[model samples]
Target: MDDQNNFGAQSTLSMPAESIPVESIPIESIPVESMPFESMFIKSIPIDLTSTPATNWDNQSQLILSFESMPIESIPVDLTCAPTTISDEGVKLQFDPKVIEKKYIEERDKRLRDDGIDQYVRLDQERQSDLYAGSPSPRDPIKKEVDFLIMGGGWGGLLIAVRLIQMGITNIKIVEKAGDFGGVWYWNRYPGAACDTESYIYMPLLEEMGYIPVEKYAKSPELRKHARAIGTKFGLYDKALFQTELLALDWDEESKRWAGTTNRNDNIRAKFVATASGPLHNAKVPRIPGLETFKGHSFHTNRWDYAYTGGDTLGNLDKISDKRIGIIGTGATSVQAIPHLAAGAKHLYVFQRTPSSVDVRNNQPTDPKWVDSLTPGWQKRRMENFNTIVTGGHADEDLVGDNWTDIIRKLSVLGGKNQSTASADNAAARQLADFQKMDEIRARIDNTVLDPATAEKLKPWYNQFCKRPCFHDTYLPAFNNPNVTLVDTDGQGVEKITEEGIVAGGKTYELDCIIYATGFEFVVNHTNKSSLTIRGREGLELSEKWKSGASTLHGLHSRGFPNLFIVSLMQSGLTPNLTHMLDEQAIHIAYIASYCVENGIEAVEATAEAENKWVQTVVELARLQQEFTKQCTPGYYNNEGKVSDVVLRNSWYGLGSPAFIELLRKWRKEGKLDGLAYETAH
Candidate 1:
């Protein structure tokens, strides 16, 4: 057992920072409740930390250290603390100098490691594999030109390809690294892999594809199958280059074409290149010392090794009945997978660094009646409704996120709304009050956890809106099981790993197997580091332009790279419902593609001024949502290690998705598409 000082250093606390200089909108005026669940990213903190008097650590393994539950209001605004003494049942707890000494040492070590300057796998550092560095041009002796070359065979890419086909752009090819379609869906086949977002709204083109999800959150197999179905539906299955990784892409000014080479040794040229390689494509492993040296059978959660587990995608892990297993990480992926691992492994030890705040996930099979009720245009309306309420925009009706609506109702009770039916006005006010309800939800978490120390640690100190809010009914209760143990590593992560198990808190854990659910890399690294070089107009490498940060009119087209589009969650749009955003992007790309071919235009790129205006818009929007910077948990949203409130601003368009789509539509209709310059085919 790790040494625990019932009393040592005082708890450090701080109020949510005031990053966005914008004035706050009152919640009392809005009629609808802003869903605290939707604002799950936002973090809140209380004032004043009263230091517990230092106590002697004797051989008291069973000693339960509990602090008095402070009220949400009573918590100090400035995070100040004073020491206190305690004498409980003949055990004299004395405030000692040793405790402070230990805390000082611990804090210093923590600062050195978690500073986000992870030297391991540093992209800037020198590497043996020049694969990351730039390589010589590997274009074919004779270019094989095509109408369109779509990168990534994921849902988004497939959709864009389908639309292009409809517009009579037949000569199109898709290059994918995976052996087949599905992109992320194909790769992540862990036992409990499923969509947390409601399947009805989350799954795209369901009615058109004539597909029905078995559960509200479709499982990995089903999701993968859906991807295949999309490819088949669009007739893109034949022209795709599977198991091929794009090596480099160089724009040939002489030919007015992009010469692209891939790992499969195929050199191809295309008039237009659409990069739909979605986020979460790359699997990130922790740089824990001795990770690779461990002589054991291991694989990432994304590449679920079913042969070792004795279960398929649907979770019947009867194979590992006698094996002792340990899984690292308590994030969303692990939350879903652990239950099955528990059932199979004789002794399952979960190595946790940071615990996730899991809300209720009332998952159920898709209702036939609900599906029947959803007609044409219902998806669009429902999607729009969800976007408006979640993003603090005025909506006709609050739909999709029921938890958000429930919180809004509570806010309305606290402060009355304009009407009982539906109120679209004062959405900003409604959202603010909804945050109040979230404060209550945080309290509810304290009430549930049996251990007070555990409860406090479990309680997320930052705003709930910072990280993706996870929903699971089974996750919390799973910890309550006698077979499972909650190893709370007070922010100081796992000490090290030994051949036996893991060395945490100076105690070694003996285990048969270890699992890592660490998650994906979020920071956008250029393809130049991956040996995929792209030279645009005047042979200026795209990498050189984006060295400081990304530059694009709408996170789609950069100024130099004409006829090239990116279809990911950049500043152009960010949404909980990824499919909706993908649909919007696909539509925009299709219009541009058709516009180019129909008008005999060879190339089109965003103008420098348009890119500048869009960047300004992203900065302005980020300045409005202070919650993203303030009160948010220390994660990718805010600079993970730094205490500052500045976050990496993203988005293509200045406004939200609905407004963005409308703008794109208007631009297409206007025929000018003012922000772009096109070169006609000679």
Candidate 2:
């Protein structure tokens, strides 16, 4: 258990900083009822966290920590423009520190389960109503074998396949649940779907694919096309089984390989397996009351019925021009797709619970002259440089001058850029710096949104990193359209879905169609993503072993699952640019697999000692982030304000993405494979 997270974890009562510049936070218009905290807080007092005795622990473990609920207005932060003082260090914001609740998670059959997604997945599958309506993979079942079996044909698996082939290991096969390669791109066909991360850094192996993105932010179709191009280039098409779902992956001691059973009758056997099944593959529709009773058309944004919508991903939704549309979410997907829906729907009702932090996305075409001027290794250098700067490291220059880099630049300045060295480690100073960034973000919303009421309603009250910050210039302006109506739920979600429309905040919004922009479940169980089980040595289910928490060394190898790698960002370097992270992991996996093949090793797995060391290191680094997350408003980043047991697990490498990649590169260069234990087939 985290010492800081325990109940009554305070020790000393003091001030934030002596003689610090005081800024009075204006709270004139903010509704008192909308805030989170209640009568639980005491008056002014700041605790010197370091003075707390280490042995004094909070042993209480429960789901919802009881709180003394109070009105936001009753909270003691001075609303008037009073100069904040050293005595005002007890300026605790909205959230009640005592009310850390456990999120919705269930442990089953010895593995962590995504309880939130079970109903959503079932409803989505039934809505399609076609057993075989997904991707047209193999109609017939057959048995096959290979040297390596990769799960999910998304960027991670494709990159691994490409790297393996490049290493002269053409015996690998990629088994994707979807009948395609793009992973999230293939699954999410919602209108206005595009990456928030810059295309140059987000798109991996650009030099290898010999392709350049057309614009700063690449859309879904282009990304999907890029996936296919990579598959073609690496000859993964012939070796891949599309629309195939694995039932279980078991070790076959006799054959010295893994026996993978699937939904199809075909059983696969491979020397190695990579569970790269990404989180975005599983489509989840919100389980609202009377959701199915609606007589009009409705579908998840992911499985977008383009035929009914009368447009492709780029959106010309002519058929829906006469229809009344209602979108249920206001997240990243909704921010992009709503504008397109507004263009088509005669009347569009955007039922929003909480407003997303929408930042500026100054998207533009890549300059052809600038592109031509780049040298051979410019792309790699640019990607590395961006990653370094974004993670608080000093970079020679800022290549991508978008919102991401801009925020980091500002943060760098606050972190003692005035003093030669960047001292971002100080928690007090970091929190102050974050305040500056959020202020700038709120100011941006004020500038873009025309209506003061709508702008204030849309301004996110939380920290910038609290939610996945959305970026789009068109989203806010769409509200200005005569047809678009912003139905703010005021924190409470839609009360219920009636047959005609949605009832929220005591208002009935009748509509012809309801579009579910609720996104997929991210940072979830592997079984949930793959919709399959993995049985390692001695019939031990993968879920059972990780029931306590994720166990991995550098997010790659697990102790029992020899020759098996968990590919996504779990227990590894987590960067916003996912493709870049995947490629680095792919390269490392390739080098290690090559080494095993050359050395005649039957299986290689992480030792208990190695896994423990890695976990400890990651947990230590995670401490810094835990405090930061507590200050932000509840979102998936902080498990919706409920830091459950699973929430405490270290999901990523504490070090930055670039540093983690360099560590792997260094390990491979050393050529010893130090942390792994090799077992030959009996």
Candidate 3:
């Protein structure tokens, strides 16, 4: 039987009629002259008959050949089994290239809205107060002065504060909008919420804390507990002003200090200020018509209403057993919470704007023996190893072997050997690998969902990395439940919400509760998204200066914003494991603060020339990423698929995370602080 005819069956390669009598002879032991051909290349592998093998072939008998080198264009491709081709990764593509490309384009175009990101409405202050009313009691305002004041209570702020305390700069204050230390973790308590990245590398400062996560993917509660533990270890609780939001920041040239104001009417003066407000801080809802008319209980996933749901994060929702629940936006958040909803609700409606690429999340409990065997700095080594592999670099062995590393390994095998070069053949090779991976993802959906039509709707038709990839063992199986109804918008979202229910595809879904898993504002400017006004030298507004684009030295310090440090992803290194990037930023900030304190420097800012040079570098490096983003479906990664100039300007450093971190380390080692200008104390 021909390989093409066996589409969904195990493929068998047909052998030649006459076989060589060399079964017992080692491949390397055969004389080059005895071979049939001198230079025969099969699947990019050259036969080396004359040389010794790299490894011992004591048990070797039969040689296995790979067909990886065959050009995809050379093979006939069709939807029928007669013309199907199998990739080296064992992924079979039955659809024609033009047909699949058109299908992808059509799917993406239907989801494109004229409003773009404007379709989402940010919650007003009144709604914010109602959601964040978890504090014990309100307190009177006061005035205070501190050596350092950090905004945000997430990993970024926690790591920076810990490093500063270690350096003996102990006079610190942490202002958190939430009632607790955990930033995103504090807000996201929806059912099935957990760190998608492997916890061994995702959780920061594990070695220092001497802690081990109970599971490979740590859940929200455990993550929140760990955040508070870090705060307690470093005495951040006493210095933190909970449930207070920063309003404005002004630099005082004469005093060489920062004057800060907050919602609680407190005045603060600090020698230096750092804003670690994370990217996904503010929650947003879609601006669907008649949203206010919905008479039922509604809440965003960020502020999960446990009282209404009658369940905790573990998802034993006793209250909603007879209730009809409707969830909007099938992104990462909804992918997690849907399984629980399907289990608890009498009827569940899933309104999807676009389907996320879901993969297997084989979570396992941490082994005690493995924990006991870790040496000092083992976590750091593991983090670096994972980072190297994901960034398309070679490693002796994969430390945290998971789905993430597996995908990158496939890409590295094809086109990641040298990512700096933008050769046409390399780009094509990488794209082929991406196609193979996405094909496997779609096949998993087909095999899991029993219904043919529903399975087809759940399959994502874009690149693997277009949107954030989701991994859950139960997301797909939840659709098999009879109570669950998938309202696929065919890319277009729900038309509107009515007093009775939600209107989508000319049908009404009467839901007792509506969960807005619409997610947070990700691809917006820092000042606008955070709602913090910053005035620098000569009364220069930070927002106005960055209106055109982001200009900074190493994405940290602006030219005029003296002593103001920003910990954000814009124009900086980006990694799938964000905590790794945060830790690197924290270390750099701590080093700078230490240097200034050791000397008599009161204010430091990036020089104009250096800032301009770095901006140019960022733009130059972002070419490849910009091209890739243009081809992706509408999502936060590409600013709803607009890919505007401003978006390109605010792109992350095109070079991978490892290179970006190395640049920072090199600058610190030089010890001159080459890009910054300092003002000494009088």
Candidate 4:
């Protein structure tokens, strides 16, 4: 499943040309010193656009238009006409690029906190148990031994289990903290909760399970049901331990096994262990002063209080009709839930820090005819097509045509093949595309929102991918409602929470309930996020080993962690469609596990040299990615704008998801398992 903590809502809004003014500037008249850094390269270059096509710019022409020898701050032109593609209507400067860059930096600065990731408090077992009282049917703990023990029941764990089952390895057990198998889907049951990515690609094993999503983007209920279906179809229910929090995992050198302990007082021993604990497993609330003193009813979006809200996922929140509600954080979660809150609350106050780039999410029902026309391996092909396009590669056709692919295609126009790198020309091109998309988004806010002041506050000034992009038809319109108010904090966020309500900008707004849409603790240490104590060979803690940064070969096997597979984004391929990446990791893990079992290999681990080489390669490739992240607004994506060495070390494989997958595929095809060392069983 995609990060439930990061999913946003969507709806369609017509593009308004009047929202953003476009002006044609003469090249000779404009001062070279006044140009923004991105426009420096084309300073004196003459452009004859009379022969250019009206709609799409020719590929050859794009290649010739390079921003190679320009300073980043000198470019002043807006070259893009739309969010998706460039037009041949001649170059027009919609806004001053240098001024916009300054505005972005100013907006980002106010949001930066000294505490960084520590500004939010991580939820623990006590909090989760209290929130989910009477969950998992309250089962007694037990001691058991198995061939494989998986640490999560999300898509990552489920996919691994399914692949292992297909490989004829059945002695497996999955431990999930939630009541069911859906992981994020199980927890985030708020009104309007749904996957942001298209369900066909985001939901894994759809073809294998012979299931078709009811909607192009499936809702939380359906996603959860699909998770259960996978468990039932593969007989995973019998092997799953629900509502169990794994406490610690220790490598048993003498027995060649992994000893595990859980919060429920259960002991488990397994020959192999795969930690599929998801990145967004823990929910967090901002560390606002006087938060504990608030007498008003409150809850995080991840742990939605349906009893108080009186609504299911469909958003009939009738219970709050007479109550004054306040929601903090205008992020992806707030974008999805605000409309529902506005509909039910007598008065709604949306407190904003940094605004999310709200775009058009024209969701539709899945076509039965399209589903029927699919031949064998159609899903794989469709998935690959989406991955290819999003990662700046050429595909025969755009299969999953959506906002994601469209924006990437626009960037690829100037970025060439490697989008991450900061080669002068590529960076300039990518920035131009990014600025264009964000302008369209801002224009969307201006058109959809009735109040000009509110629209201005709602406009996001950062790059498109700085934070997860939000799509919603009604989110902007919701602000137009007389009963709803937008309280933008000028990026300083809420000042404090009082007994009556929230205090922002030195003003107190009394609220009956406050909903925290602050999101999860991403970009932290894996052990801290998952709440797992993992000790490998010679008692080397995973946290200590990765204190500086991650040390793994292909993000799966670390040097000291024998028979321990880690399923996460760290040092692995990162993509918007997380399940696709998870499936790739699962397939690779299953192959190695099956091979080891069959070959009588007692233990396997990445060699020290191999791990070092992989880490070095990741660092070298990450230079471009780091530069891009540095320019983004403060958020989980850029480690709250700190970008420390640890963040750089823990960065995803810099070569993009498609390249990372191919690397693994080639490694497997060789049948050598080149980087791994194995100890054969006696």
Question: Which 10-residue window in model 2 sums to the lowest lDDT?
Answer: 1-10
- Per-residue CA lDDT of candidate 3, range 380-498, in tens? 89987877766655578999999878877765454334332323334344455566677779989999999999999999998677677788999999999999999998888889999
List candidate 2 segments past 4 Å from native.
1-123, 128-139, 418-429
In angstroms, the error of model 3 at 133 is 5.7
Query: At residue 358, what lDDT does model 3 achieve?
Result: 91
Best to worst by lDDT, what's the order?
A: 4, 3, 2, 1
Q: In candidate 4, which residue ranges exceed 4 Å CA deviation? A: 1-90, 124-126, 130-140, 414-427
User: Weakest 10 consecutive residues, lDDT, candidate 1?
Assistant: 1-10
The candidate with the higher TM-score, 1 or 2, is 2
TM-score per model over all chains: 0.77, 0.81, 0.87, 0.88
Q: State which candidate, 1 or 3, has the greater lDDT.
A: 3
Q: Supply the TM-score for candidate 3.
A: 0.87
Q: How many backbone clashes does candidate 3 have?
A: 0
> In candidate 4, what are the lDDT values of residues 96-144, reduced to their tens digit?
5567777887887877888887788875445455244365576678899
Clash totals for all candidate models: 25, 4, 0, 18
> Which residue pairs clash in candidate 3?
none
Candidate 1 residue lDDT tens string, 374-474: 76887778876666554444555666755533333344433223312221222222332334444444565676656666565555433344455566666
Model 2: per-residue lDDT, tens digit, 1-682?
A: 0000001111111112221111111222111111111100121011122443322222211111112332434333333434432222333233222222211011011122244224343335655332224546346786888889998888889999999989988898788777678877777777888888888888878988888999989888888899899888888899988877777899876667899888777788999999887646555665677777888888877777777778878988999988999998898889989999999989999988668877788989989998898789877888877776666555677988778777766644542222121112222233334444555666777887788887877766654555666778899989888899888876556778888889998888898988887666654666666567888888888888877667888888888888998886566776666777788989989988888898888899998888877776555444434544444454455554544446546356544565567777777777888789997544
- How well does model 2 score by local distance difference test? 0.66
The deviation in Å at residue 490 for candidate 2 is 1.3
